[model samples]
Target: MSEAPVPTGLFSGITRLDHVGIACRDLDASIEFYRSTYGFEVAHEEVNEEQGVREAMLRVNGTDDGGATWLQLLEPTRPDSPVAKFLERHGEGVHHLAFGTSDVAASAAEVGGRGVRVLGDGPRPGTAGSSIVFLHPKDCGGVLTELVQSAR
Candidate 1:
């Protein structure tokens, strides 16, 4: 006789929409365009060596009052980076949708336990001082998804 198992909700741990990840060939150009056209200012910028990407986060509403989403523009630093591969295959567009969470590892584990295909196995370092994980696009209806737990 097998024992009963606990159940977990997928969206329970997620807090809010973190941002949309956009892969582009030129990070500075994309940042400039978003800033000049949409008034979205760069909130944070960094190069994640682990991920091999130069990334910038733009505040969509131009104010970091909390309770807002951002736009993450990613420029690959190496040809093997995920963003670079995405650019080669799809050519500069939305790469992934990230959701904010307090516990990225737990969120990723819960999703994985539910038989969802998760990329990178578990949580790893992300830009903007966060831990993150990506859910495979195929499992997420062709939309690459990410879960982020901020250092803040």
Candidate 2:
């Protein structure tokens, strides 16, 4: 068997792992757990009505360089919300992995061009004023993937 060559420029804009989204039944409890257990501190918190999630971004360690990776705790605000549906199906655990990108729209287009399914028509509003889009799990090795362009 022969190995296939890696494609170029498919994820050129991806800079780093931005955050790991964890679906939770209670946002406050999850925050407290991470705080007491791992000493992680909340960096930002917001309720995104469009996504139907009350989310908090926790800094794993200290944010000395202003580029610390975050642990995003997401709690559903409604029964029909995506977080709620994920919790119902998989219980409390990781929901998605977000990668930091310099340009989400361009990155999504580039990846989509390679046959990976982009979940929406375009990038949408994300936490902390960032723009985000999800790549379909079926095309992403069964793990839901998110691309985030941090607010500038």
Candidate 3:
């Protein structure tokens, strides 16, 4: 008989908050609002064809430890994209909170074995050369969550 997966807190090996993803109807306008209103600067911006979204990462306050957080704005590039669906359901709001991981594949395995609904079979390439996977919101306190391992 095969051994069952062990249950744990599902937070082991997590490092830090990578970014807070937000869904927006318009990318440029949202970017403008953060810049003009909050004086936030875009650290990175790109269109992820695989994910079907145009995204911008705005830098938040920096800490003395040199750690940084980001406000990730996601704009759908297609009508049927996840971001589009999120907009339809939530009407422009926080989409997912991404946490940094030292080993995404391992983290995904651990989190998935703990009864979390992982969005994919495994982690895939994300923006800024990161490996990422999402945990379904239904199993994550009604908030979508992403786990990211920095490409090393």
Clashes of 3: 0
Segments of candidate 1 deviating more than 4 angstroms: 1-11, 61-67
User: Order of candidates by lDDT, top first?
Assistant: 2, 3, 1
lDDT per residue for candidate 1 within 77-150, as digits (tens), equals 99998889989999998988998777888888888887878787578889767889888888888888998888
Candidate 2 overall lDDT versus native: 0.89
Worst-scoring 10-residue span by lDDT in model 2: 59-68
Cand. 3 Cα-lDDT: 0.86
Best by TM-score: 2
Q: Per-residue lDDT tens digits of candidate 2, residues 1-61?
A: 6888544335557766789999999999999999999999898999999999999999774
In TM-score terms, candidate 3 sits at: 0.86
Kindly report which residue pairs in candidate 1 clash with one another. none
Q: Which ten residues in a row have the lowest lDDT in candidate 3?
A: 61-70
Local distance difference test, each candidate: 0.84, 0.89, 0.86
Those runs of model 3 whose alpha carbons end farther than 4 Å from true positions after fitting are: 1-11, 62-67
